[model samples]
Target: MDHVQHLIDLLRDDLTAGRYRVDLVDGLWGDAAAAALFRGQTEPAVRALDAGRASGTPSTPVESFARLFLLGQALPIGEVAAAFPRLRVAGAEELGLVVPAGGDAGRMRAALDLRPYSFVDTLGAGSWWVVSDLGEAVLGRALDKDHVLGIGGASTTLSGLMIPTPVDSVLDLGTGCGIQAMHASRHARRVVATDISQRALDIARLNARLNGIESIEFRHGSLFEPVAGERFDRIVSNPPFVITPRVDGVPLYEYRDGGLVGDALVERVVREAADHLTPGGIAQLLGNWEYRAAPPGSEEGGSDGLERVRSWVESGGAELDAWVVERERQDAPSYAETWIRDGGTRPGTPEFAALYGAWLDDFDARGVREVGFGYVLLRRPAEGARATASAAPTPAMARYERVAEAVGSNPAGLGAHLEACLAGHDWQAHRDDDALLASTLVYASDVTEERHYWPGHDDPVVMTLRQGGGFARTAPLDTALAAFVGACDGDLSVRALCAALAEVLGVDESLLVADLLPAVRALVSDAFLLPAG
Candidate 1:
């Protein structure tokens, strides 16, 4: 055991010696080539490396490793071994990172995909090596159903959205390559990462070990089954919630499809999350929810996606705070094409046509008009959860929004923004309308106002308060609300501000206060306005 541990430590040291970092990798092949390589186009990077070799530019250890693992190029054992002096070809073989090339003597091919990933979060900048199954681009064929995925857009989105508030323990369900579990370990004392695939668990464990992260414990089980009857301070999952048809000829990619017909897996995760969370614990996830075709003569609009998610949270019958944001919704056909192509079945192929037809047919059978994708933040209510049994329980927080435009950038990442918003919400939740009116509040620094005048009119046609960070929310403000927000400098109480605004606008103070209270609470939840310290 000690020898195996020492072997992995050597692998880590060798990778560090190779200068495996985002900046160095980008510098190796130039920006355009790097961009192309990330898009699964290897030609540009291959040409760059070939051109460099022709120009007498010696390959660095990172370039050699990238060529072998990332580009999936089979190189002479001598060349690959030279890059890792400590963990040479023999040691790499022992670690199962490489294998002898079939029928090609003295050469080896990568058995997996390993790459350097870097990010900036609340804990500052960090980097790590991620190992996963070889992609279709490397295999030159369709991916296997149980393929493990490397760091990608969804992975980065979830990690960036993870709140870094210090926690005792966290549960990372469906922890594919252990990306979220690794990130969770930064702020969490321990993390239990569970996945249905043993292969995924093995890879996740390798990732944790490769990064020198000791706090994560990888387990093999589907969803909450691994830690049944146990609870944690936090839970994070980017589950296989893809909407896949169960019919014949339609492929079920294990990395995306959870085998439970259309969004049922997402529903299950949301509902079951309640039982696995300790009091005050929060579960963050990314999921897809179907937007069903509304019933005839329905008064509600076309989309019921947000409401369905709310119902899932309520179905758990727990007092939980749920803030779900629908980042974007894709129509049925678009959604079908996106996932179909994701499995490496290109358009114009017979396989692609068949799968696409199956997806649409499945959607039609269930009356699914479109699919909504976004972030879900659910918190098992704090304070021993219903500790106020003797008193009236506070209403659980539920805020749903559909944000279609690009969200603003935050240096410390969205996690801090979300944490602050949730904190602000908690502070204001304890205060009633009467108490809220008596308290002081300050607007966030990322907020600004914009006024648009039509035809050079003295009165503005539209006034808007825009949040530069958080979710990049733009709140259209009426004259009274605009004045109210402008006066929120933490100087005066809410009552004083409302009175001052009413006096200026010639409106009754009582009505003004009543109208602005809800909007003020809204701004607080959006991190536009925060409780004054």
Candidate 2:
């Protein structure tokens, strides 16, 4: 038996013998530590190694101990796969290792695509390899592994950020593990998750049951074809928006890679989303877009990442609202090497270097410099705005909107700014369902409310209480502002009450309409607010 197989067997024996029950397994390495390791960091590995060395198990083989400790416990196959690194042996050979029968590389991948974090774990791999394991783990008899689904933060983030207004229908585009579909099932009357991989769809169905969520329809196909002519009140996707080439003969994972070159996956997804949305419906997604960097401003003024997204929203002849939050931008070679590491394809190997070089060459040919990747939230606007198209779609809108600049590198301040703005506007606390019914609301405490008005405007709009240091302040509101603010009892809205207040406040409502509205809409666009359509 090989060294790795022995270790695998020993762990299996330990699991079967009830040495580590499912609940206790997490105690060994907490989820955060396990998650860090699974995402390919050396800190946890080094710490675990030192801990093993200190435990008087010198030469007990640190890697073996780590694997043993990890696998011996009854962790789901998917989570285990993610924590498995690119190293050989890993002590799996210390005992007789039984290859789950008929398991090829795809099946062996269970150690990789075990959960939602698998996407980030494998994001460095330019090839789509982890999806197969996701299928096996999610569908495996463990939790009725009916669907091999790769679960991770992106999946959950997309799920959590979806506009949940109890819509009649929801469509999960590129539904890898069906996480989005499962979440949508909570509010939408009917839900469907689609992917090109039949394996993924199978796992999506299994996951639906595993999570005790029912009535989700799973379909096998690419993008919109599976749900042609199907319009939905909400559409959510954590699609294969990674701009990478689709390797042939490789069963596409359908979770992260869209099988296209450079930003096309996102463009296509955005282009097509309008067709699937009910009028005024919203589609929220996470996407990576390549922003072309030019000379001079290359370091400072790289094309705003949000512009391309705006173009996509407007292309469909839909009046639209788009919010693009650029999280990280990596250079071509750095990006290439990063993805290679993700695929478990070592950088030292000649073949791996060649593949990476090809990726760089592809970028150079396209005149692409740094790649911009982030979340995209788009809404189909109600009809009748001037049909004029701008030269630059995103930044122009962002500038015209007059949102406070992203403060510092953190952007944490951005949320605070948005909160203060909402708090300052007409904030009506609704007692019942009457839109016109006004009730006297006394401040239970002083409310230091803030309103986000056009940068130059004088009206206090969005109303949020700032309760700190044991002091409370109540900020007052106008009639229009009152109607807007009073409507926000965790429900959805078609238009922001603040925009109406801008009209009533008689501040350049047009500028307020253009600049502040997008930012206000962005809060809803990011799923931070109840659907206030």
Candidate 3:
């Protein structure tokens, strides 16, 4: 641990001394190459030792002690060694900086400038600070230092889609570096973050302070152990769902390994989520699941390669409204390699190959054909059915839209869209308007189709098209609705225009009045469209 800390400190010192420039274009080098490259230059003491031994001259104690330091930093990783090619070469340089094949001088220069390169570089001096502080608490002791983490893409994705209603209590299961707990603290009056790793708990606490967040309780326990009987209005987790073999004496990566067998971690987490949620509460999580491969043409019945996750909101019979998105999928070897690199393992090394084999063996033993990763959002409404448990879970009440273009850099745009979606209604068009260009009104659709149901018998329901049904494919609209759509030309209330339409139609005013009024109201609430009002 001290060796690792010393190595990080040396790297920081090198940056300060102009020994290397942080390049944004190039990301963090892997462990193997980094180790080999830094092997000589970063260890001046080792260099002085060899020089002194060859010259038969005694070296200074400062030089004598550098060997231990170098030994500490020697990670048995090929990637770290490979990373050395990217290091800023000082004197006589052979392979000065490694550039991709066919890369130009610009690529070489970019590799030399390590500033803007990796995610850690974006953190700047903050990264050094975080590493140092974390090192003091976790690595400095005989505890796990391999696990270093913070909010990245996965954290923010889960945070954004989580139902954000204020809640009395929140729990962040498998808190790791506590990014989720930090977000939960903003809305949850009480927030508790739990992790099996004590080192992770220390860093999580440090992060809470660094971000100026208070009132969060950080506990060292696996899963629900920290708060056994306490139910939360909201619970969220970005658990370690990576399925790895239970190797004896092997250090855990703390960030991604939950130590559960195969899909057990994810399954147990989801299955028990309802137990921890308060009535009318919600739980959102990000996890990985296994999907088995199926044979072809035999009814096409194989496991869909999907990483499925659900919120498991506590409700009676019809207990929850769950939403899941299958974000990405990977086969056994790909998944194994992805995680190994993520854990700082060097590719092609003995240890790396061994770890890779173990991961695959674990997968094969469990019959996991593919791994899926995705998000889950579950809500337990205050009033919902307690349907009988079935063999399989029912499909969720969900809608999908490709709104990537609409999601601006600003969060407000995304938040507003969600709010409007919850209302489930479109806007109402007045009856007297005809020219849409005349008004400042804008409209959105609650659903793709707008239904104009006739009262009394449910047999003949007229459907009106709001926009964009080209080529002689016209939808039916009653006179009153046509007037409402035309009046949407920019002015007039639904009531005011409906009254005028009633007078004009004059068949039986009460009939249209009773039938169409509720439908008109449904539009506004649904946010199918929004008027200036």
Number of backbone-clashing residue pairs for each candidate, in the order shown: 0, 66, 55
> Which residue pairs come into collision in candidate 1?
none
Worst 10 residues of 1 by lDDT: 384-393
Looking at candidate 3, the ten consecutive residues that score lowest on lDDT are 114-123
Task: At residue 267, give the lDDT of candidate 3.
Answer: 72
- Per-candidate RMSD vs. true structure? 2.5, 12.4, 14.4
- Evaluated against the true structure, the overall lDDT of model 2 is 0.51
Candidate 3 C-alpha lDDT tens digits along 259-302: 77776787777777776788867677877777765544466555
Model 2: how far residue 445 lies from native, Å: 11
lDDT by residue (109-152, candidate 1, tens digit) is 99999889888888789989999999877888888888999998
Give the per-residue lDDT of model 2 (tens digit) for 1-533.
65443444444343333333333333445667667655644356456655755887633222333343333223233333433332222332222121222434333221323211111111121111112242221223212222243555566456545554567988888877676676677678899888888867765664554334667988888899999988888888887776664443222334556777778888998888877887667687878877676654366655555676666767766555565666667887888776655444566777676768777777776667777666676666434322223322222122112122232221111223222322222122111213312222222122234666768878655655333211122334444434453555533332344445566677765554454344334333222233322
Q: Which stretches of candidate 2 lie over 4 Å from their true place?
A: 1-24, 30-36, 41-149, 245-254, 293-304, 382-533
Segments of candidate 3 deviating more than 4 angstroms: 1-146, 247-251, 294-300, 305-318, 384-408, 411-420, 423-533
Indicate the residue-level lDDT of 527 in model 1. Answer: 88
